[model samples]
Target: MLLRDRVALITGGTSGIGLSTAELFLREGARVAIVGRSEDKGKRALERLEVLGEVTFHRGDVSKEEDSERIVKEVVSRYGRIDILVNAAGVFTGAPLIEMSVEDWDRTIAVNLRGTFLMTKFSLPHMGEAIVNVSSTAGVSPYPNGTAYCSAKAAVIAFSKALALELAGRGIRVNVVAPGLTDTPMLRGIAGSEERMREFASLVPLGRIATPEEVAEAILFLASPKARYVTGQVLVVDGGMTAGRVTTAGSRAAVR
Candidate 1:
């Protein structure tokens, strides 16, 4: 009952990490409002989460100011106020900079970066406790064909740090959770096949990709009272992928 009677709003809650976090929050005694762009997905999420606790789904694109404002209003209208806000809505467009079109870049930033800004702006008045913005290890570590996504996620970390300082006096703690490769529908779409996913996992030190629940656990900690003194920080849940290059020779040597 870490969040007993608290109210939480989670964007991109239709699937993946956001949906997992919503379930965790509800089980922890929080009234949850899940937001997503797909009405059908939102309905499905509602059906799945309603049995756990007081859960509702709000369908709207976070990239739009009107939608962000309206969604926040609806959540507040029902829950009275927001104790936690989790900005987890994002998009990944993998293409080299020269090959990437202006439209694709704009859409990526709109959903991943602008969406976070709009949601936080509108939800601030109702939020008094915590804000956990989902970032990625890609934000700190660079890779090919991730120009827009990496930039947006990196900005999220910077944004959260600055906002944390600004909101400290108001008792609002802002933090970021940067997860590495995760096992989600989005990752499945990206990986395309099981063999490719296994290949990706082989590159990680832990030999496996993360699960949504694992990342959700981190989010729950940051959002809960357990992290009252934790703010302006980035928690990396990457299975040690970012720790250092794990070479076979190095692994053998270390074992000796």
Candidate 2:
């Protein structure tokens, strides 16, 4: 119950990691506001989340200033204030750099990087406790075909660091959670096949991909009171993937 009675605002909460985080926070006694772009999706997610506890949904695209401002205002209007903000809304693109269009590049940066920026900007004045920006291990470990995504995520980590420094004295802490491969719709869309998904999982030292709940746990930890003194830190929840592959007896571990 680290978030007991706190208010958390999570972008991209329609599904996957964002929705999972919202669920965890509510179970921990937080009044959660889930923000996303689609009204239909938001309502569906809200219906699912309501069965658990106090939750609300705000429909808006995170990458837009007006939407970000509107979403934050709506959340505040419902809960009176924001105690935690989780920037979990993001996009993934895997086209070869040579063929990647400028629009895709800009879109990637807009949703993953600019979205976090705008959401944080509007929520800061109301945020009294913490801000956890959801980065990716891709930010630190470059993957082929992930130019735009990697760049955006990397920038998010850097942004969180600078934000943490700026807000250090204000009692509002900021941190980043860089999750590795996880079982999510976005990943499913990218991998496309079970074999491809398993291939990705095999690269991890832990021999498996993370579950959305697992990454969400790491995010909640950073946002909770236990991390009061922890800020400007990038917590990599990759199940040791970023730590490198493990080998035994001079043999490579079997890929899942």
TM-score of each: 0.98, 0.95
Show the lowest summed lDDT stretch of 10 residues, model 2.
247-256
Residue pairs in steric clash, candidate 2? none
Q: Tell me, by TM-score, which candidate is best.
A: 1
lDDT of 1 by residue, 1-256 (tens): 8999999999999999999999999899999999999989999999999999999889999999999999999999999999999999999889999999999999988998899999999999888799999999989897999999899999999999999999999999999999999999889999999999999999888889999999999999999999999999999999999998888899999889
Worst lDDT 10-window in candidate 1: 135-144
What is the lDDT, from 0 to 100, of the residue 4 in candidate 2? 90
Report how far residue 161 has shifted in candidate 1, in Å.
Answer: 0.4
Candidate 1 wrongly placed segments (more than 4 Å): none
